[model samples]
Target chain A: MSGFSATLGHRSYEFADLRVLLAKATPLRSGDVLAGIAAGSAEERVAAQLCLADVPLERFLTDMVVPWEDDAVTRLILERHDPVAFASVRALTVGELRDWLLDYDTDAAALSAVAAGLTPEMVAAVSKLMGNQDLILVASKCAVVTAFRSTIGLPGRMAVRLQPNHPTDDLRGVAASIVDGLLYGCGDAVIGVNPVSDSPARCRELLDLLDGLIHEYAIPTQGCVLAHLTTTLRCMDRGAPVDLVFQSIAGTEATNRSFGITLELLAEAHAAARELGRGTVGEQAMYFETGQGSSLSAGAHHGVDQQTLEARAYGVARAFDPLLVNSVVGFIGPEYLATGKQVIRAGLEDHFCGKVLGLPMGCDVCYTNHMDVDQDDMDSLLTLLAVAGCNFVIAVPGADDVMLGYQSLSFHDAQYARQVLGLRPAPEFEDWLTGQGLLGTDGRLVMPPARHALLADPSGRPSSALPPG
Target chain B: MIPDEWSALRAMTPARIALGRAGSSTPTRARLAFALDHARARGAVNEPFAVADIARELARRSGPAVLSVRSAVRDRDEYLLNPALGGRLDDASRAEVDAAAGHPGTAPDLVVVLGDGLSAGAVNDQGVAVALAVGDAMGERGWAVGPFVIVRNGRVAVGDEIGARLGARFVVVLIGERPGLGATRSLGAYVTLDPRPGRTDAERNCISNIRPGGTSVADGATRIVELLTRARAAGTTGVALNP
Candidate 1:
């Protein structure tokens, strides 16, 4: 139990232990060790009591710290270091910071950094760092030693939907990036690039735009650039929905409607791609984004009640299901926040239904801020994360070629020294690679980094010339 | 051009599609069947202890393989109430998949199962693709897979008895879905690492639906090898961390 000296002499109370913090406070039993605060008001009194005895309050409340000895000192430190997330936490020493990280999850460097004093600006930077909302920091690579490896022939290939007139910058960029990344990472496993534009003519324009890239770096596998999907079409059959918009309370229906229109248009565009014989045509779908029930109100918003964005998601998910067969499933982003209680309940249902039914949930989008996601956010998201049985991530190496090259294989902190910038091998599974004795003379693994380095410098550099440790 | 079934589908109007930069695709029952048969023929798994066979054996030997996984992986009450897991076994299930499957190394030429068969409609829709992919992969790799039976069940072990009967090395079971509120009738592939019936998740690998939200066929195929290889070493799947 913890309490602050808010009384200057207001009310003095004591607490026994904290496990019952969530429970309403009661009068202290004579010999029972209890903690409470003497405050100006009832809420203040409760808040002050919570601040005493160095209670692990961050795990409890973010806005309820009281002014007391440690609370006062902690608040001062928090003011200095910038503890803005939880109002309850004003200050933390190095040890406290470590404790916070341990509680928040230490595997994430950003979380640890935030515990050390992060600014709001840093939070924004982190969210924009990756394109995928799939599982964070996840990627895997494998070697394809033989030709014609067992690759299933899906009905189509990786498709990018383009607007009617021309391929928009977003479409082209996202498509090309996905293609390039896959090509580089998966190696010889990816097929050709395709597009899904609105109309037949528009689809043709998209292809025309890709003429150069198509000719320059085309794979032998068949692909498409489809368009002209005016009528709603089915996959393999007609009963299937092309899209699904499961929703909760409505908030900003405008955005939801817009998204719906855009998806319908997407269906049309896919039809165009198919008509055009583009291996890459339109086949997109999404799930609802909700935080509440399927009401028209701001039902699905988060914390501010919910992610007002969820209603929009639900609206969208409900629109294109069983109606159109093309699976355009997507997760609602940054809206609803299932609280701890909600998380447990949801987890129970998720586990029960998941085990009982084979229909596993798919796809989720996360909008991470620079300061690292609040601990509560992680708990809320876990409910959904657990639903996606497997990870389907978009590999984003960003623009740092060296980082990309390094990521092309794998590297850890210890391997950082061997890198010497862009000179060594960065093969993933370095442990296995080294064990297999597949390394450069410098004891590095064989990878694109080494090859790229050789291309730049044929002659070896002097060890003495290099910066000394 | 649209396939005849699509054009004639009860609900949808066959929309015109483009050939775009890539050529166009024409659909026909014959084409669909051919496509599926082609892929399956290509995947004839002659190698004993094929992934499918292992998955089936696990279910036969274990109390309930896929059901156990479904119990933990779902969030919704409906899905939890009727959970589904792919029905093939892997290398690890060998220790437990009914004494017959719980043995070591390769065993049958085929193993078939059902579970939400890919997603219920897969048998009717893209079943061809799954069949083709497996058959083609096995065949090209010098294995022989039969034109086997596909079932509609919550679990995928429906085909196991057949595998044991034929003395096949593998059994490829496909199941129908429990009907997702939104995306019902989708399909996925689960390959057991060992050809056993009593095995668990550690003994299998999955190749989910061909839809956008699911794992791509190509990606799924690649992971299957590693899954098979690892399950061969570990004897389990799912939560049993893969090395």
Candidate 2:
């Protein structure tokens, strides 16, 4: 393996290989420190970044992080490289790529045109050398949109995935949260639920509930039960109304194995979801969730840094053409991110990498109670992501997920993001909200009357509380 | 003010709902309420465990004798930073375990360990009650239950090493779960058969959310006993055994 070296003042720093260089160059995160691969000092990290900047971008194409034969994620990345798109930036160094990305001339169209030419490694390497502002600025210029029942990632638009989880999957409890989110104009991305159990029967019950609600109200949004792939496939086998097949994916084959998934299995699930023909606006049927430290948590990172590995997981997501790919950034706890600042940096980096690779990236800007983070930290990250043009964000009823036991943004937080940034929900969803009189002409959520129709019974009959509409 | 109609929905679930907004933001009272719960949960994680007091209380009960030990972790920061360290015994504690379980003759039928996991409040408040109840149930079943090992700053896998050293056939670890804003002092029970090192979560059966408002101590004890009985009959636990 070839070595990389740089000198800071009188001292020289040498990295043993490309993997080591990538690990040391990554900004401070606790996961790499726990993995025992982080740079020894701040100066050493700067040295590695200096060395990483001079490396030609083409070198990433040849020097694989995980061996090509040992990992299918690597194979997919290499096999799908578009040489025609690479011809334009063939000779740029990693440093030059950073400069080019931030150049005023590089607009959304320019970034989209070269999306296929870059691999996860190239993107991850360049991200290591960029600052947080640089990440947001470049990511803001790259637009990757997709649609199902509603559109996402469109310019001047932000969506919310209504996460109405219940501890026991009670239909009425879930219904209450759904009603809260709908009134606040917050389920445009998808009305997703993280079930307490992974059983097919339980998943089917929730899916039926969501499907029925969407149909009854004629809501311009899709529904997803975040269950395992096999469980969802079983639900589909039972002829349940399945809209999206969801799974948690990782960067390496070993980590994917720990998740009980493989590339072939994902392809199978993708084809199966498409065959159902449930999508009305588009065929992107996959929804994947990734994070910074999942690979290390599974003991499958192979000495690679967590941020780089996170980018590689984006590689897996892009192959499936997912409708939603979110990084549950802080839910993994303080072990990976450690503090509020670390979580904020990671959220921006993930959004930038996924968007650069041409995927509709969202963020679950959240934190577990055990971590040294709070709602204030979440507010910072959420505002930054909205500014960076994130496709969507996960919102619960009151920023408190009683079922999952974490703090995320509230439905009101999404409205706040959209309101301050001059962003709207997906067009179809905004139209639906307007028609239902939940959105005012001024683009703000109007408080529904004490007897709104959405608060009616599950049988679609008006409750006594509902006045004649 | 909350509308009268939302009362029915609020009563259905513990989730925070119908929190009236303040112009695209959480109302001041709702935000402050959430902040208070978050502070309580964070305090639960950082609160020190009164292990000595709990050990004395357990020893006074008419069940198994209580023995106290510590994991490899020195403090809360280390415990939060590197979880792998929390899953093993320190050298001194390992020696203490070796001296306590003399000669490793016949493996005991069961070993119950009380670990102060993320929330010390969980173990302090409910750990003794659950341990004594479980010990009594196991005794009624005519099983040889070893002394309860109260571990400080311990993780779930710490029971594996302690049980393996004591030569126990099965180990049940009653520990604090990661504190949630809604439930700060929630306890969990993890049962592993033929306890040893390197046992993954797939090799254990778990009963979680044991507290006053959640799973009662009596119900948790009954479930643990049932799982143990089934494990003994099937000669396995975890993914292999049906609970």
Candidate 3:
């Protein structure tokens, strides 16, 4: 079958024969005809031409010269982008930002700084205008350093966080999620729980249980009950086994005060936790969480942009020499960032800024219900952040963070990342998993010989069939 | 291009007063600006002050030193909820101020204190500028200035007790103003003569909106010093003392 011809720039080229489209019976323009043929073909020769040929994709789209404007072909060609939204984004510059994004060879840090310098709305709009190829080009060309920083108990290996949250402080329900994640070869960096009850005693009880789990399973994971520094300090005073001290920090002093945390207090908590020497694997014993919205939400941003303020919070977090500093990116609802596009851009900016600041950065790729997001949105963001060399990701059961009332990565999502991205759990935890016959030498997970007994009994004897570590 | 109808008007102020709308909604640019400003307003109200940090910064900037004090308001939460409590000093704070006042060379002809007020962020951003300007203006006029004091969980009137304790003839307070959408970093100055604990807002004269956009620090400082001079001569502030 004959395919259509189109003029791109100054050159005229013929598209390859779209083998599946038998006839061109319509009076559509060559672009529209090519789009329909592209949509209908098994080989997708026309679609390939649209990408591979010197087709001037941006120019063609910007000219608004579509013959069949209402057709699916036109929509696909435009990436289903909102015309008004794209126009607004394009109005910012004459393809300067797009060219910057397209220049994959540009320094990742430079690109990140540029990305961060943009307003959140600009970032969000640009991201919405990007096609799959544009995203891939951007993600692939960036540097990927394996484990730029490490948490305690994990050394130069990709880590996964197990967030076992429960509404009633039920250890059993929390244990179920933790066991599920652990069995899937997750929870290498830390097993941090967001507890529903704010009581120090209740948090201390959960910390004690995690301590027992870590020892009994010989899991190379530190435990943190995400209570306030004061609550965690009280837990320490009571001689509870607290592995990592946790605090919610913001950019400015006043914002920290509103949250009842101060830099001096953080320093004190860091020193107290360090003196306790609870973490067995690494020297650092503090963990911090920050987000762009907190400063504004807490009324302390000082009229500084949220990204800059967020970076300032990282400065505060890094001073404590934390084991892991995760940006709960979209955990705050839509008030600060209204859509998934904004959340993803903020996640990348946070990752880049945190990495630049020399902190072991991770992202709780999450969103509340009020935001314009879903599981798929989180999946896309999680994949991009992982590819951006994020230190760790939050792994909860079923992508549900019940206690926090948000959605995060699921245990399966962790496995999927390791499989697709060639990422591995923290080295020590990987060794433990292999010793338990749960992971093969190739780093792929294997069915346990005795799945039932292993989960039921944390102290169960190692199977003789287990691979020697 | 046709001249924008509001071009000259918009240049006069940062406030989005006469921005044209689009079919009953704010235009995209105007709406986004409004949102950003609204966010700034919210941020100012919610920010907390690390009083020690501000004091250390003040000490670094100049001499005399910086003293830390607290109001009767126990914490930021209480301070936000109970405006009345923020107006007075706590017992321990009173003792500290009195003890410090007893130290030799601590008393001065003028006492200045900075408070976190409704916008701690404002105080942090503009407090130092306004304070330096006031101090330099006072120094040039040959007025003896006391150590800079930073009070946490305090309102504007808390400076009265601080000034009275030090036995200064005049007290000047630079506090974070209640933020507006366009002016989150505005710091307000409250000047009083013969400072006492029971002084009310009516007994003090205010020079407000002291920031880059509203009132420049130099102008605000001059206003404060001028008000103080007049208040000292009149032996009063408020309606009785005119600049």
Candidate 4:
């Protein structure tokens, strides 16, 4: 038994070499490739042996890359670390992996990395292969929620948003989603509406309905109809309660103008709302939304990069001292981001930038269908944001923003985050939930007696939660 | 045969209605002219208003003193994204307006605010000229108008806060309207009674398309006086007071 003094320095093997290795090299035969690398002139052997992995690539790569003489090379190899790990994950049948992961319970970062490493097509394939139970088990295993100190608007607490959007301000559809969200233990932080109509009268109706619900149910949440500042101002003037002055903010003047918003206008709106005592819970009375691609979309980037422009938007939001500042990263579409990889990277960048700027940063972990993304992509981004101490995520029904036509986290998704990550709703909201007997001691919903009445009717009629129009 | 009607209409207005066609498409010349106008419109929206320069220009031109103020929007980017912000004065601008309220005998019946609404080109082109005509008309009417304030990055509602803060009964904000292909430099005068924040657009009377080609500067200024007089007397501007 002659031991070869192998000092492999290369970072990766060639694909053709890998293909050949996969076709011919058994575990025993894989040792032959390793031995070849160990012999004199290991670089050439390593290059050729990168092929012929009849053995699992993970096993093969780990064997080859981990023992490199240079630590830098080892780290570089680790950077491409997913292939080996992925190969191992790929080796398990859906049932086998699901059962194993259910009881696995370790640092979820690795599982997330594996999930992230798989392509959307691959993830879709896995989903199709797995039973419903197994798929859920795997998802729970993949969520990694680290305890983050600073929170969104409130300090040191995780918050969840309930976004009940309606195209025509239909009270029934709006109430149903709200009811659904509340049943899923949401809306303690903010129960805001995304209104398609820019009409002040329509907005007033939406605001009135939301305000009515908040009081009627004693739901501990702030409500806002994210209409234009002018409309919200009208709502206040008409003696309707304006909970939050919402605006889509941007970094540059031209872009902000494109959205029909200006910081000065926001100040005026804030002043109007504050004068009316709308934001009684906190000093800040505004909710601002921003994203990376808006400046570019509005043709107002001013030659600055998207991320820097996004940070500048945070600067604008901070200047207003807003209660909620959301960065809807991938909602813009593929013309700006082009792919989920880009979207995921941009989401992380925006979140980090907002957090650094001391913003109560919540990411709209979302993507439109036109963009190259899937549920798995959102999950990867969501898990990472949760780990990074994101304040809250938007919860629409079925992961679909029906009005905005974008895909975002659903209430069930929030449940998954809470259950698997040991996270809970915002503290004040949690207390209200517990006191109301909506949430149990174990951080799950207690099956409200009025659940059936509150949920949306299949006939598209208003549920019992819908107040008299 | 080339239509004589289109040429006649083209002679009358800059509107695209008179554009002649080449086999179901606009003629090459007409298309090029449309493209040129579109470019001008784009340029008008993108151009930055030099607030101090406009103030200097207005002050140098004569009549009332020009006081420079700004909307809550800090810069061009902010001014664009948040129209609500553009509708109110920033703290510094508010302080300036507030300080002006103490300027004895300067509290006039009308407060004129010159704003770069959507087109800086329009403000640069005709804002000062229009303000002068409006001032001359108000002077003849014996209405004591306050010093002119050039509001940088302002919307229609921006004048409300300026007027309220200045202790004026009326505010005449001459802002640039969103530019159209045929009219890149159209200026509009928005008149409000008892001006303050949260005044709806319907509460204001707007005189739009003030330009060399549209409403002449003198005509616009004259119409503003008419609206102002009616607004003050009627205690309203938009629906309640028809000028």
Across the candidates, what are chain A's individual TM-scores?
0.29, 0.97, 0.67, 0.66
Cα error, candidate 1, residue A134 (Å): 29
What DockQ do the predictions score, one after another?
Answer: 0.01, 0.67, 0.01, 0.01
Least lDDT summed over 10 consecutive residues: which range in candidate 1 chain A?
A138-147
* Model 3, runs deviating above 4 Å: A1-157, A451-453, A457-469, B1-243
Distance from true location, Cα of A178 in model 4, Å: 0.7
C-alpha displacement of B94 in model 4, angstroms? 55
lDDT of 2 by residue, A56-79 (tens): 989989899899999999999999
Instruction: Choose 2 or 3, whichever is better by TM-score.
Output: 2
By lDDT, the candidates rank as 2, 3, 4, 1
What are the RMSDs of all candidates, in order?
A: 25.0, 2.2, 23.7, 21.1
True contacts kept of 4: 0.00
Lowest summed-lDDT stretch of 10 residues in model 2 chain A? Answer: A460-469
Q: What TM-score against the true fold does each predicted structure earn?
A: 0.26, 0.97, 0.47, 0.46
Indicate which candidate wins on DockQ: 2
Question: What is the overall TM-score of model 2 with all chains considered together?
Answer: 0.97
Q: What is the TM-score of chain A in candidate 2?
A: 0.97
In candidate 1, position A211 carries an lDDT of 41
Estimate, for each residue in A122-176, the C-alpha lDDT of model 1 and write its tens digit.
1111111212221222100101011111111111111111111112322333233
| Proportion of native contacts kept per candidate | 0.00, 0.74, 0.00, 0.00
Cα RMSD, model 1: 25.0
Write down the lDDT that model 2 would get.
Answer: 0.90
